[model samples]
Target: MILKKEHIQELKNKLLEKKEQLLKESNLSHSIIKELLTEPSYDEVDYAEVSSDSYNLNILREKQLVVLKEIEWALKKIENNTYGVCEMCDSPVGLKRLKVKPHARFCIECREAFEKEQKNSR
Candidate 1:
């Protein structure tokens, strides 16, 4: 394994734990959205409170979903023997970075470049 056996196990455990937490949170947000959308007083309810809660739920769900997607991607990378390699620069992302952010697909330098590009685009 590119990762030491122990490290690989730890990564897997962390990803699984995070995945479950995200799924639960995401599902709860989705359920709330559905409830709000189909509320009994569909037209009579206070739009401000409902909209505010929905907006907050959306942001939270969005962040959690992104993390879930990243974890899934990382797991696939591990299966493909491509884990720990930077997707952008093709450099090995050190174990320390992987430990800190197991879903990281790029090294610090490449990540910085990518973020800069993203900021410019926005």
Candidate 2:
């Protein structure tokens, strides 16, 4: 089904909001990384805690980067008038799914199948 203009606009708004939030988180993560680089002025236990926090922040930053890329791709799809369509099957991605995952590239069926294939491969 062809997506309504209002729905597309809504999706675009959601993507933009998510992009902004991710960027803010990324900036915070960078600052935390910089702080992590400072001299360890604490005991071994404290140092270990710092290291753990740094590792967690790094993982969070990596995840944000990935989501940011997906959001960018989604914005591009919106510009090209192809947002909300499954890349794998050329079908309309359900509105409910899109609401939950605005940057999704595949519909639920295709995504599940793809995930199953990946799992079987591993």
Candidate 3:
């Protein structure tokens, strides 16, 4: 099915909002990391806790970076007029799926198949 201009604009707006939120979160994560670096740990327990928290923060930052990249890719797709097209199947992705995951590169069927393949491979 052909996507309507209004729907495309709505999806774009949602993507833009998500991108802004992600940027803010990323900046906050960086600031927190810097603050953590400056603070000194007093004892072994404190050091261990700090280390664990630092590790968790690093993981979260990495995840945010990945999501930010996905968002950027989605925006590019919007600009290219291929926002809701599945990369793998070359089919229009469902509006509901797109609403839930605007950065998705595949339709639900393709995504589920891909995930199953990955799970089996693992």
C-alpha lDDT of all candidate models, in order: 0.70, 0.74, 0.71
Model 2 CA lDDT for position 53: 70
- 1-122, model 1: which lDDT tens digit per residue? 45787887888788878777776766755455334332121021122344577787776665665566678778877888888888777888878998888888789998888767766765
Residue pairs with backbone atoms closer than 3 Å in model 1 (clashes): none
Task: Mark the regions of model 1 whose C-alpha exceeds 4 Å error after superposition.
Answer: 28-53
Question: In candidate 3, which residue ranges exceed 4 Å CA deviation?
Answer: 28-51
lDDT, ranked from best to worst: 2, 3, 1
lDDT of 2 by residue, 20-111 (tens): 78768678554554444332221111122435777878777766666776777788788888888998899999888888998888899998
Instruction: Estimate the lDDT of model 3.
Output: 0.71
Q: What's the distance in Å from true for residue 65, model 2? A: 1.0
lDDT of 3 by residue, 3-109 (tens): 78888788888888987797788785645543433212211111224357778787777666666667767777888887789988899998888889887878889
Error of 1 at 76 (Å): 0.8
